[model samples]
Target: MEQSTAASRPWLLLLCLAVAATGGVLQARAQLDSKGFISVDCGLPGKASYVDGGTKLSYVSDAGFIDDTAGANQNISGQYIRPQLSRRYHDVRSFPDGTRNCYTLRSLVSGRKYLVRAAFLYGDYDGLGRLPVFDLHLGVNYWQTVNVSTPGFEVTAEAIVVVPDDFVQVCLVNTGAGTPFISALELRPLKMKFYPQVNLMQGLVLDVRLNLGPADLTDIVRYPEDPHDRVWIPWADPKEWMEISTTKQVDSEYDDFEVPTAVMQTAVTPLNASMKLEITWDPVPQPHDLSPGYFIIMHFSELQLLPSNALREFDININGVRLSEAIRLVYLGVGVIFNEKPYQDGNYNISIKATANSTLPPILNALELFSIMSMTNFGTDSRDVSAMTTIKTKYHVEKNWMGDPCAPKTMAWEKLMCSYDTGIPPRIRSVNLSSSGLNGDISPSFADLKALQHLDLSNNNLTGTILDTLSQLPLLKILDLSGNQLSGSIPSGILKRIQDGSLNLRYDNNSNLCTNANSCRPAKMKSKLPIYVGAPIVIIVVIVSVALTLFCLLRRKTPGLMKNSVKPQNETRNDGDTSLGLETRRFTYNEIERITNNLQQVLGKGGFGYVYDGFLEDGTQVAVKIRSESSNQGDKEFLAEVQILTRIHHKNLVSLIGFCKDGVHMALVYEFMSEGTLQDHIEETEMQDA
Candidate 1:
């Protein structure tokens, strides 16, 4: 476990601008909206068509252009991502496995300068507790290697690429450094002049796009309100800054894209804005004394409409250098944007103070910071991907089979092998199922793997006639089917293939199985199976006859005896034909009494009755819910509960084992919920609060 240090690690390539040769920052002011902008929320399956609240750019799920197979390793699900700037990052597709997973961005105009950005937020999503570093690629060309040293921050990689083809692909290649995953992917069409001064070949990296304001505020400014959905988040320290809003209309001196109007509406100033405002910007913490270059963009607007005579002036000082001598504030509606010279990481603090001539204190509406990176691999094959998916589903194999199966070569699924030679799509070369306790017939999908070489299914209860298709695999060299219940004549074609020395076969320990083509026989079953099944039923029938005879005699002496007799077994099954395959047993009154010791040892009580702790004959603890004698909805609730419990099953859920009903006396047994009642915890909290 090594911690990344400043000396050994790459300088977090923080982006866009640095102080020019003359010590002034480069200010990129505009962009003309074009027709070809594609936004993709990676790993999303459905067509999620919506607009981003931050950028106001409309994006759809990646399914329209790319199929499921192309997204071989999309794994992130059910994680609460932060910022929530846009819905795009909620469910990510990860690459816990696979050497490379590529997303092909189609319908792109060839020869256009496309601005592509890929975002990643680890959020410790995999719970591995370690961040991953991997390469990001554009088709066959190398883009940028995304190194996420910190968790919970959305790392974005951007580049200006000239698309040579109609469609450009973004690929993520795992370099055996860490498990790579992607949150959001964006492909926007850009006009030639989007980045005027920067070299097109050297890509710009996005470090931080912050909207410094109150931490408690979840308000993110995006499109419709601003026309361009540039997301602005609030990050002001509540104790230091005061949220101030102006009723006056704010106007964009330039385009709204230069300084978003939504952010300009509200501003954060020092708590005592009536006095001289002083702000010390907090510098991002670094691993060592080394300085990583960064870009900062500050947004400001005159919140108050001041008289022309009362001039509001301030100086921008960064690390002790003034941007200019004296700056005059525009009227209430007009906004101001400042792109500061890049600074090195240190005890650096950005301060903005009002001059003596200023009528009002300084106010900052929003600010953003970024780190730059340079430009990035292949996607996994389609056929092998489909075949592997079928095998897992058919066998119901529950393993960490997330992400692409082979790309990040080191993370291939357990008990599986893939071909890793170079440019060609990887194929499933081998599958090992030995000692995995497999049963039922072999999945026919296994035969679809054209490149399969070795197939092992030893030490299992698998049965069924061998499919001749097994011999159809042209590359199969090793076939092991030993220690299984597979019985039947081996296919003649397979037998010939085995005899001709083309197949290395193993078929031992299956006594009923016939190896030779001429001596085929049907599988024979154990001779004692019928006797073992019929003996118990015969004993139960004789006992039932004697009990019935005694019940009839007792009915003559007591008229109510026949009414108390247990309803016929068929009566329980006649509940409108909706058993739904629930594994419930019909317990008799005597059996319930034996298990619950006449309803002793009450665990708890509900509206129904006393819940008595009991155990099955196998010593499995259960809770016997005996209905209260005064309960009104006993029969209805019992039937309703039975119908529901039979359909639902979960680890946290208490399993309904069986039920007993003798006239009005109803009882239900459930697997114990050892965690105790939720109400108990609530009551304990109440007591502590009191």
Candidate 2:
């Protein structure tokens, strides 16, 4: 039956968005530094910036995203989740159906261009072992379908857009396939000239971003090193390709068409600079309504410290058309060019051959392709911004509330009313903080909003005064303050207004709140029949009896744990739990090495294996235990330890994060136990005895 179910499962159809990864193509020197850069380690919260030994560059946690909702902040746990990553990528925010999940970005310069990058890695973070497919959006526009086709691998989509107002909204919509989620996201400021032709059409949809000519295949280049923080994936010299590099410096004048110095430093030139690269790819099938043309870009810089007389000139050939001739790349200078062209029929790849050269062989530092689209700018309302800002602080809301409150009307912040207009920014008109677990006095500042007409602070723990200063609002009509701890007699002016039918009041369920004599009386209870009363008692007796019986059965089977005993020192586990939860991730042996930096950062040596302190991609601290090859502990002991750790959870107990069991190589991963061990604490308590 299980095999049948597995066989019936639908194989995921990859909805890979064909976006070409192209940085500022129009090239300018205007850049946003770390302070201006917005990095959102979505679904996770941590503040860390470090120089990654692998990338040889500094990467910081995404800085500006608010978790204003009550959604779960989850970390994905799966066999395929990659290792040696900052912990941030492991975090995700899941969205339920019927409501769209959105994140707003603020602290941005208006009318400035930005590179929006959204990353997703669904390593079954919920531990369901099932990958989900969903859609990712930019403002109210559809961006791409987020399909976790291969486990542990990352899928990313990017777009370049101008900041319409003071903010922008990145949202996730549930297409009814599964709960949508996001792992990490970032925004880089670009000059208006980044995509000069972008104004001629819609925004550019990213397809591929590739870095060429690296000795290492696993090499990845990212931030601090590349001030723009463009992620450059390295492509090493393949067997079919010949690689050459000169110890000469290379530079480019077009700062907006910037190519990373790291990539430009190395060049991929054919054995014969005259021979063209016959690159051919299949046509990317497009929907009937979408255009299939792509904008191709190649980056070049003068390589090889040479005399001024040496010149590298080549013509670019795409398909059968010769796009450029007499193109020269001067030493220590840069040149970047791109053109929009449709893919050749029956071929998905475009061939770029270097022919008709002037001096040197053809070489490329980097290349990218993007689908062009019209530019769009949409943001939130300026009015009523302060009221919500004050409300967020007063309630200790999550930082996920970064974008506009209602501009893109379809993706408004939860429980808020707005006056949305197509070309005009929306204005805050109402707020509903119902059943939100809010605790405090409803701020009088909220009463000052001139546009606010309806305010619902329902089912909260508000205290102090009733009908305090809220009556001053001129447009106020609807108010719901029920199910709270509000006290004091209703103000005479408010009561008269409520009685005169000038306002719609919902002030029920507040125990101490008094409006009239009948309203002051305690809530009446419904009486139960004798059979109902007796049934509950009988049910309770049966539940307690069954619980006690199970307790005895467990105690009998796990006698060693019930009564403490001095067991063998070599033993890894004691009898405790019959089963376990093991909510953390399980890693493979290969992943363990990456997470532990090949197990080089050792904290201490144990009887079973060495303990190494490690951090996730987002810089979260953890400890990994790699079983020793010669250890006497066997499979049974390892399983017992894992089971015991999973069964027990407490503040004082060390958490078993995950484990690895590959053939004979077994290991355990755990949360780092700080403040030393319990034994150390006891020993310090009896310092004189030592």
Candidate 3:
């Protein structure tokens, strides 16, 4: 989840090595290395630049993050910086990317004697690139930053850090925290020599007791009767509290400390919303470990024990083009998602350039996004992403499933996917009508869709048998009939027929589906011997008997035995024969069917129908083309191939050997050629010459 290059890998690895070598608990201290380091001083025009106010940032991924405002006026004291990532802005000042946001900090001073510390409010748990931050409770990993200040200061006990004069990208990361919040940040001159050097500790310990509304919060409270009435103090005794720097402390008397709290709740008020846990600690006067620690005994309310998970969707957007269903987002700590889409609409430079004052390396994180027409929730159910895409492409439904559809382009209504069918007029490919409380049977007109692939009618008040007409589709892939009041036998016939025809059937939770023994009741029959045995035998017998009878009749009616017999094998035959013609075909349905073997091993399906991979007796590979009854152009293509191949003779054109003319079953059989079609060659070029 978190990636660090050898050069850009966090100093944590070096810190780990240091701890290992030290044996004892290595004290958090500041080290000064005069080695080559690039440092830029802010406010010197060319040296330090500012991201002017009103500059736009576009988040092009599910971890949507963007720069919403111009850089805060050089805040030397770190107070009241406008919210960039989490704070909502109207029109001109919207948060560009989703949470997991990042902002650039510039280095102001580029010299010794002055240690610069910078901090910002991090949301969605990671720093600029969605990287994790340190924990505030249970110890020392709460704040992360580099420090060149001298040792002897217990400054590493806070949630902020100080570093040298280098351009760095600081990301707020907390693997344990579900969401992130920051109230204030500070940057000041560090008096490193004044603090006493101590061994590095991973946790921060506070010792102050808070006056509660007649309750004890010394231990972890599970289901507390009144969480609102119960106030908590991290330290046990109030006397243990000392006057430390204001920037480092997390929580103090609200009257005293300038910290952000959840929308406040009165004492004894019903806890309707999930309470946000807030932890604040001292600041790091120097660089220290800022990994997430653990939570000690804390106070919480009892109304009920509620464990819930949040959902997050991740997408990728390369360059300016948006891909569809590209990224998978997962939560490391809560095991759920926090932010959804990362990219927002606008122009971006497509680079990771920092714009603030700090001493951290530039992070190489970019955004990617996928385009979805529409998405909807039917019930308390999670649908497969693939299944959802199929349904949308099937019903000719329309929606901008990914919220906003076009960027800097004309817009359509929400929940619509339109494809350019001809010269730009849109053809709807998907529709999501789940849980809209609609009542009716699915319109039979849906089967008219030749390009439809996905259809979802779950959790609705629809009633009807699975349409037999649907089986005629050559592209239909996913069908959801769950949570409906439809009564009928499972459409096992249709299922078995289309199992290999891009059809995925989902009919569970529909109680009316019958699996008993009866033709009227659709039996859930798996595709195997039984259905194959019955259907193929009848067709095979009829085709073979008809072929033999026709052959016998033709032989008797011919003028001579030699004339009725097969032609002598000749490699030196002329292109044109008076009776047979130059290009001719004489093949039986039985032969074509036998060669295709019940239409197995399909190469691909197009607007016509399935194309099967086959080989002649001579061991040359070929394509067996079949026309689907549902294809509007099926007959047209068959006739076109016959007419064109008869005249066209080139190395590129297929050499037609024969064709079949079964009733309503038109096919073309050509000399076996290993080379595939031009389209196939372009799509997969690595294959053997075709």
Candidate 4:
């Protein structure tokens, strides 16, 4: 919503007289305790926090709530920083870098109601001398468009919402007309019983909240006066109504709304007691809202003491339709009434008429009107959101990955395709992370997105074998793993799907990868001679074997010299042989099972196999990575790792103590790291800092 222009009515000049008579009644009030309130000065410098002198509300810098690289902080032009203006309007946090910048408000109770307000005062902070228009969003749904028409005037938007998650995100979206900026953000926890029309499917955006009695133009009712901090603007219409007030405080102890005593004590009645009290207004719909509806609430109280045999009662009417039979006003008592549903009419006229049996005129103290904001868009599915979050964190994919991944359609994360079905949350259909600078093993988090159809991880530095879980995706149609350093044989389930023409797979340029078991095995040589030459071939083979036997006997006598000549060939062989001589100790399969207590405790799992917690004979803790039978990693890869570990020495690298190469079992044993993985440690540090 844009800034509203106040009407230059003639009766506004007489408001000061009415407020002057009652000003003394508001003094000597207790200080308001600022609990459950989040007040932020958007661009305040440094990490300092302070209380505002005027409101006594605590304000803090927005550094911890927003990303450092998302925006820049600057002060407004000095000429506009008037003494009467709030300190928050002197500076702004302007987003000139991205289309969507968001501030995350955490530690909110889900399903609880809250009042969120965003204020903007464009004092030409950029020194451009031009007003900017932008859109604001509450999470993934559109709240309103902020069109700043005046340079020094402040425009504020407020909404009462039932937060759907533990936290809520307030986002400023650039509409290309100008850069988006914000001066301050505030949140106030509200009682759940208030605003009965507000629900999970809809929110109430404040259109107007006015105190209908004569008061000073600058005297806004909030904070210590109202307790709930609801901003109540002073309204006057002396042409047809006259103000009536009492110095006695209005009792609102039993009321849920608890309208401030200052507001309820002063009220307006018809100038002629015989005439009806009427109010008319025409609401302008927001740009994003075509058929806006309104929910209105009116507060009333009897300010004066009445004698016996005198009764004050009125009937409330809206647009010529009667809303109630009759409302009786009790002396020094307050009552609040609101519509159960929203009114969709463009024009509204409220008439309060005295009942036939009443001897007094009707009275009204306060009114609040709000436009219904539909929150039907459920945004992205939770499962897809969680999985995408994991993938983004794992790969550090920062290409506009903010807020809801697939929400609003126009601002979906880059390289992602989402499906939006009517009445259902959006689902991620495709993800392309090609050449995104991703490294290490392929994250298993991708498999958690059940609705995902196409995945492209090609042209990255990813290693490890393709996970077998990829073949389990029911809707998966395309899988691309090309142009990487991935090794090992493809999973059989994937191969079956490929052969049936159900899934299109890509794995080109990976030199070490093989298609199947037969393709991965070494090729055997065949003789070209016929059966007639078999006898001569056997005789020649025998003669060569006899010469080799004599040479072996001579080599045994010079074992030291033979060892140097044969060791290089044994190390370089690519065949699936387990006889490679290594410095690390080798254990039998039974010994491995004994050390691991029959593989009872699993440390973790990966593409190769599960890692088990084990202990050596000397009570040294170790992690044993046992290869699975269906694992794509073969004997060659195992032998290569063993040789590399023996040759390398680094303080950061885990020490390989031994290995297992018994029968068909293959395992690697290394010193256990007491701390968790590097990813866990980094996440913990970030959470603490945040």
Best by TM-score: 4
Give the whole-model CA lDDT for all candidates, comma-separated: 0.60, 0.61, 0.33, 0.76
Candidate 1 Cα RMSD after full superposition onto the native fold (Å): 27.1
lDDT leader: 4
Residue range 1-690, candidate 3, lDDT tens digits: 223233122111000111112112223223323222221222122222222232111111111121223112221112222344212111011122232223223443432222222223322222233422332211112234322121111122222122222321223333343333232222233333311111122111222223212223242211121111111232222232211111111111211111111101101211111211122333223223232222112111111111343222222222323223322211110110111222222222221111222122111111111111111111100122233434444444433332112111223224444444332223445445666454556666656555556767678777767776777766667777778777665454554543334555666555554422142443233111110122223454565466457555645775463342223322122232224343555455565665554565565666667766544444333466777788786544464445445544444345665555555666666553333344443344445555
**TM-score computed on alpha carbons, candidate 2:** 0.55
Query: Relative to the unseen true structure, what is the C-alpha lDDT of residue 537 in candidate 4, on a scale of 0 to 100?
Result: 38
Poorest 10 consecutive residues by lDDT, candidate 4: 8-17
Question: Per-residue lDDT for 624 in model 4?
Answer: 84
Instruction: List the candidates' TM-scores in order.
Output: 0.43, 0.55, 0.20, 0.66
Better lDDT candidate (2, 4): 4
**N/CA/C clash count, model 2:** 52
